[model samples]
Target: MKMFMLKSLCLAAIMLIAVLTGMQLASSGIQKMKGYEDPNLETAVSFHEKDNNVKASILGNDISSHNIAAKKKKLEEISAFNFFSSMGKKLSNGITSASEKLIQFIAD
Candidate 1:
């Protein structure tokens, strides 16, 4: 049972690492795609000026601000989770190393 649990834990760690790596890769890819500056700023502004609705614009800005706040909170949560996960990984590695050393000493 202990061995099974260890195997399961290791599998979970591997899966987590893979998922994090994939997310990093995907984010980097998106960043790369965003390297170019938007070339239609004047055109966009002209279009917006043509159909300017004050109330709707204010509502849209409010919604955008809310979305930004939500995304910021989610980013913070993800950062905290990442920190804890990394600490756990380091602790597990230290324990594993200490156990292996103790086993070697006992054998000798």
Candidate 2:
């Protein structure tokens, strides 16, 4: 019994150490990437801005106004989507909790 207890404690300690080490490694990797910027994204945005400028100049329109309107529309769509998604999640959680309670009550 003593040997079994010792082995179990050793195993638990080893597992704890392994988990902590893995977490530290993962956090450090994430920290290193925090300041990393995607070259592709930067290039794409640059190209888009240049294209908008050319188009606006050709058509004699203000590019800033068009960009602002586009950005506003995009933000509104994102906000609406997030609101509906969060509501759906809450509804699902409520149904799950209710069902669990009902099951427990019936079991009792």
**Best of the candidates, TM-score:** 1
- Candidate 2: which stretches are off by over 4 Å? 36-108
Tens-place lDDT per residue, model 2, 6-87, is 9999999999868756765665576567777444321111113564454332123345667889999999888755788899
* Candidate with best lDDT: 2
| Candidate 2 RMSD computed on C-alpha atoms after optimal superposition onto the true structure | 17.9
lDDT per model vs. reference:
0.64, 0.66
TM-score of each: 0.33, 0.32
- Per-residue CA lDDT of candidate 1, range 17-43, in tens? 687567656655665677954443111
TM-score of 2: 0.32
What is the alpha-carbon lDDT of model 1 when measured against the actual structure? 0.64
